[model samples]
Target: MRILIVGGGVLGTLHAWQAVERGHDVVQLESEPEARGASVRNFGLVWVGGRATGAELDTALRARVLWERIGERVPGLGFRANGSLTVVRTEAELAVAAEVAAGAEAADRGYKLLDVAETKKLNPALRGDFRSALWCERDAAVEPRVAQPALRAELARSGRYTWKPGREVRHLSATGVVDDRGERHDGDVVVFCTGAWTGGLVRELAGEPPVRKVRLQMAQTEPLGEELTTSVADGDSFRYYPAYRGPALETLEAGQPQSKVAQEHRMQLLLVQRLDGSLTIGDTHEYDQPFAFDVTEDPYEHLAEVAGALLGRPLPRIRRRWAGVYAQTTDTGRIVHRERVADNALLVTGPGGRGMTCSPAIAEDTAEELNL
Candidate 1:
């Protein structure tokens, strides 16, 4: 089968990788010269501990294994098992941490609640006054700058897939795609992994409902000079990810909003000290339609303040600041849709913000769905 996959985000790359691995001739096209959307702009977390404790939880668990398997199957992918530390600063935050631990237990996820001393022991960077931490041993992190391109290189090296790096696909058909250059390459199937750009492509393909893009703002700090055992965040970050939100969303929705920590917002601080000394800290979600991306300095200041409060260490240097965008679902979950007329015309998107950690397994399933 000759498959033409549109949009070379994480999911697009996954589709191409799996289809090629399964003996299909796959061709992946992207609008940007490189990945310009949320895939490259995230904290690169392969979350295993924070997903809702049912099918979503189960899938995330399997997804963790998938992240590991990729490293094994294709070496140098840079997938790391650094784990993650979710901290608690207040009684309410501690309750939320306990809530997550309970969900992990019910879902048979291997996680342990860390007391104050234990939390400090796990991450020496943790500071301020914190009550507890939920440690999920299997959860991991990766460097997207290394991993995504590595996967793309692996697929290209296999020679089973024809990768067109700068090809901007303007139109898609059950057969193949018509490139921006007025070139058409017929194929057996078409899959759109456009991420935030899915809305436009959906209308072009005349598909159901639609996919939307949400902007995420993040910042990276200079070398922290310490090895972080895992990615870390608090209850504020948990509520944003549906997997972490769990079955208590209704309760959470009704919960009163706390006083503004700063800037009229109170998101928990998230941190992942990469293999490099630099700590990858982030992120605040500011949902917008077609054009809602502005990487301002205010979010960075707020992030540093929160991180300082959590890590108990003043960041001396902020080497970089940036933004990311990902596909969002009305239901706030990943959407994997198929057009009724063409079984091969599949739309793999709606990851919201968890695409990095979740796409590996999803890509495997996508290949299966395409029967490649």
Candidate 2:
């Protein structure tokens, strides 16, 4: 089978990987020279701990295993099982952590409520005055900036995968697609994994999907000068992840309000050190459309303050700042908005923030569903 994969992001590349690994030829297309979307602009976290129970958590766990296997085969992936820590400063926040850590699913998510001593001992870089931390040993990280290209390189070695970038699909045909160059690429099946790009070809084919675009602000700082052993997040993160929702979380939310800037921007501090030693920190969520054309400063300021508080020192000078948008299903229960739009074509997207973490498993599922 020759599969036509539209989009060059992680999702699209992983789909290609699944097809090629199954002895099928794959052709992946992209509009830009590289993946210039949320796929590359993310924290590269294979986050499992924060996922809601049921299908989402199951997919994350499967993806984590797939990532480890793929990483061993493709060293360029830079996958690391360094884990994560959500630091809590107030008693209210500590209570929330304790509840979740003792939940029935704690073992599956690798949740452990760590004291101040344990927290600092696990991640010595955290010398701040935090009360305790919720440690998730199942969490991991990868190099987002290079992940797609690295995967593509491995797929190329398969001799059955072809990548077509700088080529936009202008028309879809029963057999395959016709690109802007007026060239026809034939295939038995066509899968669109077009990230946040929900307009143009995608809209023409599938109409308005049951997905919304999300915008976020993130930044990278100069080398931290020390190892940050684990990825870090603030207790404010508790409000965002569904895994921590309980009575304790409710009390914490009611008693401990976020700072004005943090609340207004819906911000959380998630810091991860890159292979270069630079810290990738973020982010704030913006739901309404007509999103800001430029990145705001307030969120960054809030992130730096929280990050400094955790490190017990000032944050390194920020070297880069940017904003990215991703598509998420408005129907939160669904992991992605996948559907067959045409006889030979299917659209799979809206993994949202899970794009980086679950693309591999998602792609594998796509293959099994289509019998590819």
Candidate 3:
């Protein structure tokens, strides 16, 4: 089968790789010479453990293994298996995290609930008022901007997939799809992996899926030279990836710690030390009808303050800031199966704010579906 994947971000590159693995000829068409969305602008946490709740836990574990395997296939793209620490500072926060841990245990999850002393032992750089934490030992992080392009290069080097950059696809034709230049290229399967830009192509299909465009603001700090290993999430970071809290937020009620915290501030700020010693953080979500990828630092100061409180250290000076737009579905879990588009084409989209970590499984599923 000849499969053409739309959008050159994480999903596009992943789909192309999976298709080639399934012995199908694949080409990924990216609008820009480089990715311009959430694919590059993210904390890059593979998120194996903090999301230790419900069926999603199992799915996350699978994604974790998939990430490790992908890392083995393509070395260096910053696939760090340092796990994640959901730190708790206050007694109330500890209580909430304990409940999350209990629920995860009831669900038979693979996470470790650690005391503050134990957490500090795991990552010595973290020093603050934290009392306890939930650790996902299998969690990993990847440098998307670097890892993704590297994956694409490896695919080409192995002679499996082809990537076409600066090839903005315009529309789908009866027999083929047209590019920005109105050039039509036919394929056995045409999949839409356009992330936030998916609506423009699938508007006429009446997709019942409630996919929305969300703007995420992220920033980086000057190099700290600290051995910061794992991804860290605090109270203000939940709005972006609520899966970290599991069903705790789902059943959170009035006057509850998490409920009150969530109402006052949509999320807790998260921090992750990149491979180069600089900390990457931020990420406040704002919805837009058609999202734009421009960043603002209005939220970073507060975010930095929270991170400083978490670390018990002065906040590092900001070096750069960026905003990326992502396609998000009302349902939190990832979308894997093919969407039944008119005629025979499938509109494959993953809008769970994790197009990179979750893309391998989705792409593999897409390739198998194309075989059918």
Candidate 4:
């Protein structure tokens, strides 16, 4: 089978990877020279700890396995099972962590309530004043900036995968697709993994998917002198992830509301160090469209303060700051929005922030469903 995958982001590249691995030919097209969307501009967290129970968690676990296997095959991925630490400062936050650690599926999620000593042992860089932390051993990280190129290079070696950049799909058909160059690429099946791009042919074909765009602001700093063994998040992250929701979380939210700036930006502090030792930190959520043309400094200020509080030191000089947008489903219950627009054409998108964590498993499911 010849699979034509539109969009060269992680999701589409993973689809190509899956098809080519199954001994099928694949051709993927990207509008720009390479993907410049939410795919590359993310924390590269293969996060399993914060995923909601059931299907979302299951997909994250499966994708984690796939990522390990693929990362072993491609060393450039920079995959590591470093896990994560959500540090808590107050008694309310500690209660929430305890609740999550005591949940029925806590074992599956690798949830452990760690004291100050145990937390410091896992990530010695954290010298801050915190009561305890929520440890998730199943979490991991990857190099999002280079993952696609690395995967495509491996797929190219298969001799059945072709990557065509600077080409956008202008029209779709049951048999294949037509690019902006007016060239027709034929295939037995066509899968559109377009991420956050809901305009042009996507709107024409799908007619306003059950998904919306989400904007976020992030920044990276100069290399830290020391190693940050594990990814770090503050207790505020409990407000963003569904897995932490419960009576305890509800009480924490009521008692300890977010800061004025944090509430204004819908912010959460997630910090991860890159292979070069630089820390990638972010982010604040913006749901309403027509996102700001300029990135604000208040959120970054808040992030720095929170991060400094966790590490017991000031952050390194910030080198870069940017904003990105991704597609998310309106219905929070659905993992992603997958629909068949034609007999041989299917649209799979709106994995939201889970694009990095769940792409591999999502593509695997797509293959099994289409019998490709």
Candidate 5:
């Protein structure tokens, strides 16, 4: 089978990975010389802890396994089983953590309520005043910036994978696609993993998928000169993830509402250290279309204050700040929006923030469904 993937982001790359691994020839096209979507602008967390129970959690766990295997094969991925710690400052937040930790599937989700001492032992960099932390040993991280290129390099070695960058897909057909160069590339199957690009041809074919765009802001800091042994999140993250929903969460929310700035930006503080020792921190969720053209400083300032407090010091100088958008389904229950747009083509997207965490498994399922 000759697979044609229209998009070079992580989702498309993972599809290409699956197709090529299944002995199928794959050709992936990207509009830019490199992908610069939500795929790269993320914490690269193979997050399993906070995934809602059932299919979502299963997918994340499967992806975690696949990520480890892929990371071993692609050293450039920088995959690490560093896990995560969601620090809680108040008893209300602690109650939510305790409930999750005591859930029936807690072990499966790697949920453990950690005391201050235990939390410090896992991530010594956290010297802040926190009552305890929710430890998730199944969580992990990767280098999102280089993951695609690294995967494509490995795919190239397969001798069955071809990557055509700087080629915008202008026309989609049942047989194949026509690029901006007016050249047609034929394939047995076509998959559009177009990320947040929902306009133009995408809307024409899918007629407005049950998905929408989500915008977020992220920043990278200069080298911290210290190892942040585990990824860290503030208790506010409970509001963003689905798994933390329950009576306890409701109580926490009622008792301890988000800060005004946090509420305004729909913010959550997630911090991960890059291979270079720099911290990648982000992010605030903005769902309305026509997102703000400019990134604001208030969110960044709040993130710095929260993260700095956790680290017990001021954050390193921020070197870069940017905003990115990703596709998400209106129905949060769905993992992604996969549909056959044409006889030979399928559109698989809307993994939302889970794109990085579940792409591998999503692609694996795509292969299974397509009988690749």
Candidate 6:
């Protein structure tokens, strides 16, 4: 089978990987010289512990295993099983963590309620005051910036994968697609993994998928000057992840209101260390359309304050700040929005934040479904 993959982000690259691995010839196209969407702008967290029950959780676990395997094969991925800690500072937050840690799926999720001493011992860099933390051993991280190029390089080894950049697919034809260069690339099957750019060809084919665009703010700071053994999250994260929803969570929310700025911007503090000793920290969620043209300063300030509290020191000077948009299915239960846009072409996207986490499994599923 000759597979034509559109988009050059992680999802598209992974699809190309799956197709090539299955003994199919794949030609992947990208609009930009490189992917500049949410794929590269994310924290590169293969987050698993906070996923909802059922398919969402199952997909994350499968992706985590797949990530480790691929990381071993592709050393440039910079993958590590460092895991994550959602630190709790108050009794309310601790109750929420304790409840989830003792739940039925605790073992599967690697959920353990760690004491202050245990948490500090696990991540020595955390010298701040905190009661306890929810330890998720299943969580992991990868270097997002170089992930796609690294995967593509490995796929090229198969001699069946061809990558075409600086090509914006103009139209989908019966056989394959026609690019802006007026070149026709023929293939047996076409898969559109277009990221957040759903305006032109995407809208013309799928007619507005149930997916919505999400805008987020992120920043990279100067090297922390020390190792952050594990990824860190604030207790506020519990309010955002579906897995943490319970009576205790409800109680915590009612009793402990979020800081004004955090509530206003839908913010959570997730800190991860890059391979270069720098810390990648972010994220405030802005759902409504017409997102701000520029990054807001308040969210970054809030993030710095929370991160400093967790580290017991001032945060390093921020070297860069960025904003990105990703497509997500409005339905919370579904992992992504997939549909057959044409007889020979299928459109798979809207994995949302799961794009970085579950892309491998998602691409694998696409192959199995298409019998590639």
Query: How do the residues 275-321 of candidate 6 rate in per-residue lDDT, one tens digit apiece?
Result: 99999998999999898899999999999999999999999999999
**Candidate 2, residues 324-365: lDDT per residue as tens digits?**
999998888888889999999999999998999999999999
Off by over 4 Å in 4: none
Of 4 and 6, the candidate ranking higher by lDDT: 6
Q: Which stretches of candidate 5 lie over 4 Å from their true place?
A: none
After TM-score superposition, the amount by which residue 200's alpha carbon in candidate 5 deviates from its true location, in angstroms, is 1.9
Write model 3 residue lDDT over 1-372, tens digit each, in one string: 777888787877777877777677777888888887888888887865544255456666666777788888888677878877878665555555666567635334446779878989887878877778877677788986697788887888767577788888777766658888777778877887777665555665545556767677788999877888778887434323444454444333223444333333344577888878899986666764555545544577677777887788977888988877777666555454347675657776644565666777667666666663
Identify the runs in model 1 with alpha carbons over 4 angstroms from their true place: 103-107, 199-201, 243-256, 259-266, 288-293, 332-344
lDDT agreement of model 2 with the native: 0.94
In candidate 5, what are the lDDT values of residues 1-372, reduced to their tens digit? 999999999999999999999999999999989999999999999999989889999999999999999999999999999999999999999999999999998999988999999999989999989999999999999999999999999999999999999998889877799999999999999999999887778888999899989999999999999999999999999999988999999998888989999999999999999999999999999998779899999999999999999999999999999999999987767899999998999999999999999999999999999999
* Every candidate's lDDT: 0.71, 0.94, 0.70, 0.94, 0.94, 0.95
- Model 3 C-alpha RMSD to native: 3.2
Top lDDT model:
6
**How far does residue 339 in candidate 4 sit from its true spot (Å)?**
0.6
Ranked by TM-score, the better of candidates 3 and 4 is 4
TM-score of each: 0.89, 0.99, 0.88, 0.99, 0.99, 0.99
